[model samples]
Target: MSNTTRSKPNKPDARAKLLDAAFSLIRAKGYCATSVDDLCREAGVTKGAFFHHFKSKEELGVAAANHWSEMTGIFFATAPYHDHQDPLERVLGYLDFRRAILQGEVREFTCLVGTMVQETYDTAPAIRAACEASISGHAAKIEADIAEALARAGMKPDWSAKSLALHSQAVLQGAFILAKANGGAEIAGESIDHLKRYICLLFNRS
Candidate 1:
């Protein structure tokens, strides 16, 4: 074998860095507040490199939203949902995960979709649509998990899975908003605990 190894191309490296930087910055700041210059700086790449990878900031925002959705969807799907035998326990575990994420204090209290919705919904329709789509996708994943729990318990719901899914999204997103407004994660967790109770009641009723 030759002593020298082949070097990876710069294009993929630049693209990955840009995406990672966009993800971090958008999560820290809202999409509208994060400029292309900021993204380039965060990525440690020049504006020319950033433009080479993403034609426009809107395009980069959409890609970041997609990346966020894919990553978080996998996390929620595999997280301790089936740990308990009872459906109610499983539901509470999901809520507990959300609470832990809130209280961890390592990450900022920002959901990509929520950030985009608040920042770019009126200005950028495509970016807004991407965020909305990501929200719906998360809801669907949660709904499927809930449906699985219902099946395991030999129970059925009067409402469709989609309704339950949307409700879950609303609860969590509302909790985030409350946390932001209240200047702490405690209020958000408390508000979400009520949602936990609601889910338990729903599970018992089914």
Candidate 2:
């Protein structure tokens, strides 16, 4: 007896595939343009599988934002910037890391939640809130380093560390938009360079 038929490989979980699809498609095409059909196609799943995991497209968007946060949280937490003993050095290293990651296409390096929230902020409250949390939470991580640096430098600026942290995100999000408009990452790297310079001036570092 010849046994020639091979067993099929296991497929990824439908929900996880859908999340991965959202990350790619939304960044490439933006949120309002990417429909359920697009996500299902990209994920290699059926419409039924999509609907089974998500009650609505907006619901899926919210989930995607949270998933992005969780994934990037692990990424930034493990980044080598934290290895610096001096807090100012750590902050500058973080900016350097951001600059270094601007490879490939604009869509490949841009933030997923930032792309979604820009389009959905007015229409989808749940998605907007989720995106806000993701951006703010990451900013808070930077704020810790900024605050520590401020203390070490004994510089009591009128502005709060939290405000400066949020401003950094504003610059990054704007840089992504500019990259989309101009079709490259050079502009984004320029913005990061300016940000790093500003941090140095604040910390009185050369």
Candidate 3:
């Protein structure tokens, strides 16, 4: 006989459900509009489960930021950096990934940290600090990539990797903002094109 019963409420990972719900809602509806009830409803979990995992919505936001950082870090880890023999091509490949994101093929250009940074950077010190730290960590990773490219080319960097990384992050973040503001991908793609030119100018490679 076939028996059918309702699935367990605490099925799968409750914390993962909560995080997924929070990330989706925040991405879809923005951070300010997402609430505990919204997350619980979206995750099909109970309030007890939500509160059991996260003490507050702000805590969940921080957790979501960390999750995003981890997920994207993994993406960059295996991205097409080694696809081309030229070190400059590797750098260009990295920037091209950013362009794809702007084009909304793999992931939207919307960055969780960038979203939060725009809203609370000046007013909310804790949230701003979290965003700042995440951005800094990402910048460091890009710096390492830039250093690798320089080393592979047998050329010493006139500028520090950290500075180049910071610039790259700034350009990418700005492109995201323009994309969101313009309500289209044109601005983002164009901005990145300019950024690509800037990168070529800096490295003296095209």
Best by lDDT: 2
The parts of candidate 1 lying over 4 Å away from their true place are 1-12, 85-88, 104-109, 151-158
The TM-score of predicted model 1 comes to 0.82
Tens digit of per-residue lDDT, candidate 1, span 66-99: 8777667666666776567765566677778878
* Residue 79 error, candidate 1, Å: 2.0
Across 1-206, the per-residue lDDT of candidate 2 in tens digits comes to 00111112276688988888888888899998999999999989999999999999999999989988888887788889999999888888999888888888887889988999899899999999999999999999999999998898888999999999999999999999999999999998999899989878877799
How far does residue 70 in candidate 1 sit from its true spot (Å)?
1.8
Count of steric clashes across candidates, in order: 0, 0, 0
User: What lDDT score goes with residue 165 in model 3?
Assistant: 84
lDDT string for model 3 (119-198, tens) is 76776677778778888998887777788777876777668878888988898788777766778777877887888898
Q: Quote the RMSD, in angstroms, for model 1.
A: 7.0
Regions more than 4 Å wrong, model 2: 1-11
The order by descending TM-score is: 2, 3, 1
For candidate 3, the per-residue lDDT at 180 reads: 69
Model 1 has an lDDT value of: 0.74
Candidate 1 vs 2: which has more TM-score: 2
Q: Estimate each model's TM-score.
A: 0.82, 0.94, 0.83
